[model samples]
Target: MMNITIKRIIIGICTTIILLTIYLLVPQVSNPSPSYETKLTHGTPVSDDIRAMLTPSIEPKRTRAIMVMQDGKVIYEYGPTDKIMNGHSTRKAMLSLLYGIAVDKKLINLDKTLSELDIDEYIPLTTQEKSATIRDLLMGKSSIYLPASGEHDNQITQRPKRESHKPGTYFFNNNFDANALGTIFIKETETSIGEFMEEYLAKPLGLQDFDSDNVIMGSPWFMPKKKTMHEQYYIYISTRDFARIGSMVANKGRWNGKQIISEDWIIKSTSSHSDLSNNHINYGRYDGFGYQWWTASDTNTIWTDGYGERFMIIDPDKRLTLVEQNFTGNSLLSSGLWLMNKNMDSGLSNLMKAHKTLAKNK
Candidate 1:
């Protein structure tokens, strides 16, 4: 009995140490310390109808954070904009921004194929799959479709048979495309995503709540059971920081009297290169796809969204940006979805009402 107890204690200690080591290996970030409201400056106030949308929902159904900006000023905010959360697939849009800069610097060529870059996956890429170009990946038309690191069941199941369609011929959003793009970015720029993000975005934009701790050099994470050759470089940004990014995008990639990315790149990146109409998507939500951004089904507005309601919506014509973040405190799918979406629509509409600077022709 004594020997068994001793062994059990030793095993428990070893298990705890192993868990700690794994946790340390992967990057982790947290909410603000001494958490305070992220309301920096209030822009033009809105009417009561719009104010109602900015108000938080009841209890666990409420969102964690949201911010709206018009013409580089914060019009309103709800919850702690300083709160940090996984931007999830929204990182794809962020990568789009970086790619714009990289392309401007002649660091990468969109037409460059995976074959030319020598890109590969754990499951191995067929010669046909390797023919997909960086442009195809950005447009989510790779159609290479193999199980990737961040794939969920739906993604894996939705994948058409490999090589079912030629590169840039069909549109299918897959992790392999985004993850491989991350690898290609690192290889071409010879800079870690985190470092480049800091130098190009956070510092230049004067982001208040930017944190670099969760910036990993590889895929968002690694799993022993699931192996993938490409690593996903996830960007962890705050709601406020997201608004800055959206605003920059809305401003044609210009910030603070400086051209961060060429106007041409921004136009190309946000334009609907891939039309989703008549696609098999049952949801039938999005109308079109740009490099990484999604277009509103009814409006020309550009937006990017991630899991758990992390969203950044941009309307260059109106010069408006709206950002929201939630740590799954509640979901739009929950019973409260209608209410949340209603408020979101109202808030965004009011923000756009504040400034209607008609965008020039793209």
Candidate 2:
């Protein structure tokens, strides 16, 4: 019996030693935190005030995440803001950023017509749709049409089918419409969309461990996974890095004193490129679309939207970046926008008040 007990003790000690060695060698904790040091006159007390502004007006059935960064400091964060979460179509914002970098590098000409490029095979649009330029698709004006046709239809109710249009006249979001962009990305860049995202946007932004692919079709994650649908139709990002990307956009795509993407491209991508004519189409409190980015003309806050309430809102005038993630439907996006507008309204008021107070003391 003593021999048996001794053997068990020895095994336990060996396991503990192995774990200790791994703890030391693996370097689990990241060192030298991501650079957030930048100068701004706003005092740090606003973090508390911002947190107070995040109380949702509605009963919280959905999971909500929020992060606010002002002047390079994380002023406030609420809810499950640390966990990795889906960023729905908000991924388009990063994709647009990648597109801009491609333009800046001369890899793509934003004005280049589809016919001149001879990459018509990828786009399933008819002749009219084929005439649509890269800018058209970026601005959400492509002839691509979704199955539901401007209604709140879930993915399960729809299987994306290609419409035989004249190829540049009308736009919809079908499989062909979404996948064609991926094909064109591969053809021109000689790299997959995932590769392009990494090489251009994510890597430079220090999101080296991110993952994204052109998922052909699947339901929103909140829905039960469908049969035979191997992949979902969006990019997943941790909420934290999602906020990091927003901060980068708010700073005009600069991180850690490095120009990850050109400032001019950032500006153009986030501004109002075109007016979405359809009154039925909801753009989450935005007045217009700008190269995959949504612009709130009223607040001058440009944002990228994802399905399931993922948002990366950048307020240039206030120098604030807000990111929010929610599992519920458009309510998160709508409410988050409402909450953001409230915070921006209140936060700026506080800062101005603080400035006035300082002025009086001086």
Candidate 3:
């Protein structure tokens, strides 16, 4: 009887192991999301003719990845979408997202003066600088031009003389505003940018790359002085994950059926606060500057740019989100004697043209 019992027990253990292995190996089907749309399914890319049309501009040697999503699904993709690349200046847009959430929760008021927030640089803020509001900073109108932490070498060289312009009057793309805003965001929300981003965005949006360990975080790369405060808040994100960010904004801050960010904030933040038509070549016909987001003259569209030729163009009118990144060299100046460090906008421009054609056909 003991031998029989031992054999049965061993068999039972084997059976349990086999069952557990089977469960682990099989793909589990998750319950459908409330706003699940059959049309939003992936794997079926756009037609061959369209791909051929896009290949020349998008699949060059230096190009890393290009993903164009229509109606929240990948319509065309070139290169590896899983690769995480340096975010550069595009990190400002992500900070703006955090600001939206904070503002929505009434934790930070846009109109609050810098003085009220106790924002001051080691160089000391002028009375006019202290009077600049958070909204002015977001809009790049905080005319308080001191030696800013993380201020770009070129931007520093171009920095308007200290206290030259008053707050909310001029629009200069300064790293100071972005960095200071980041510092303010952390202080007000009592959360690190990485934690807020991972919790508020990555996890909820089902991002494939960069979990808690590798989530987007800030680093002090552009700090010129040892005593300087705010760091250049950097975010390392993948192409596909950024497409999701674009899609989220394109939907006016809605993800699936849930309202991830308020539509009012999206509209307000994306609307052009500074007119950049005469300057900034990146903006289209009537495009201008918004709160960290570059506003297109075209209705219902926002453009986010990264230094060295990265871009995320979100067009709500066409239900499209396009992302391109990682240019090893400027193809435009590769053969030229002077290969300047200028950004190559050809890929994105070509993509925009293709998008317009596709939208018209649809």
Candidate 4:
């Protein structure tokens, strides 16, 4: 009888284990993860006057989403804010945040040379490339001139010849610098960038949308050059979550009183490290480059612009963050670069107008 009871108990335990495994494997459709609170009580609604100013700049079908957060509350949002969209070069800013955290933890040394990291793939690095430091890459001054795939027309046209300028002296807006940095980050952290982001950033910030699965490796234009090593590689995240990133920057790397990243790193990464006045490619409104973010010539606002006019703008003085995602089609040519630039410029201008209007009404 005792032997029979033991067998029954074992069978019961095994069934329970199988049932638990199935339950965990199935997607949880009912109890979804928590996201940022609206907190509409804290801020005034976006006035109709401001909406009129913004609507002209944003095309409903072409523009995926736009979100505005002021003083830690959602003040305005338009379009499908919950939709996941690709963040092109804007992913560079996200990578910059990870670098800051790694630096703070002593996991990565900014002064480390590329040669020391043993980061070589597809094409071997030249001697000059090896000498570039991590800091140089962060500043977009890594004078390792190489033909980076999927680069903008301006970047390709303006790229300096190999060995023309010493590392840390010239700025080229080279995607190779950013891609190489991603490789180095992986070498130092022993974690994929996407996994690291999910564990350290997304979960901690209470972001509703972001996962390892959403992290795309390489651009289709550049195959065989390691996805993680593609500077043009992207992360697909919701506009609201993207705004949270800008909000963190505006708050000096703090989220809800917790220091997600060091305040010093935030200052250093957002401040103008390279003047772009003479850069061959005119970013139009932007005149300076920080670690990976862009800075306006006259304002404290720091921003990141993705291809096709996707942008995340952070204004520290005003304690405001805005994210706009315009994902229309595969080719950016559909919108044309000129129109894209104009759209971004107008969007930003109208956002400022909205802010002023809200403040005036209050």
Q: Residue by residue across 27-119, what tens digits does model 3's lDDT show?
A: 211112222112234645767776776667444645468888877788898886766666678888878987998898898899999999998
Error of 4 at 105 (Å): 1.5
Q: What is the C-alpha lDDT profile of model 1 across 243-350, one tens digit per residue? A: 888988889988777888789999999998877876666424578898988987465688888765566778888778877776532121331353355432223343
Tell me model 3's lDDT, rounded to 2 decimals: 0.73
- Using TM-score, give the best candidate's number: 1
My TM-score estimates for the predictions, one after another, are 0.81, 0.64, 0.77, 0.79
Which candidate number would show the highest lDDT if scored against the true structure? 4
Candidate 4 TM-score versus the reference: 0.79
Q: Write the per-residue lDDT of candidate 2 for residues 290-341, one digit (tens) a residue.
A: 7777777766677776555566667775557767676432223433455454
Which candidate model has the greater TM-score, 3 or 4?
4
Clashes of each: 2, 23, 0, 0
Where does candidate 3 clash, by residue pair? none
Give candidate 3 regions above 4 Å deviation: 1-40, 57-59, 212-227, 278-286, 298-300, 327-346
Query: Global lDDT for candidate 1?
Result: 0.73
Which 10-residue span in candidate 3 carries the lowest summed lDDT?
A: 28-37
Q: Which pairs clash (backbone N, Cα, C closer than 3 Å) in model 4? A: none
Residue 333 deviation, candidate 1, in Å? 23
Whole-structure CA lDDT of model 2: 0.56
* Model 4: per-residue Cα lDDT over 31-53, one tens digit each: 22445333222366566776676
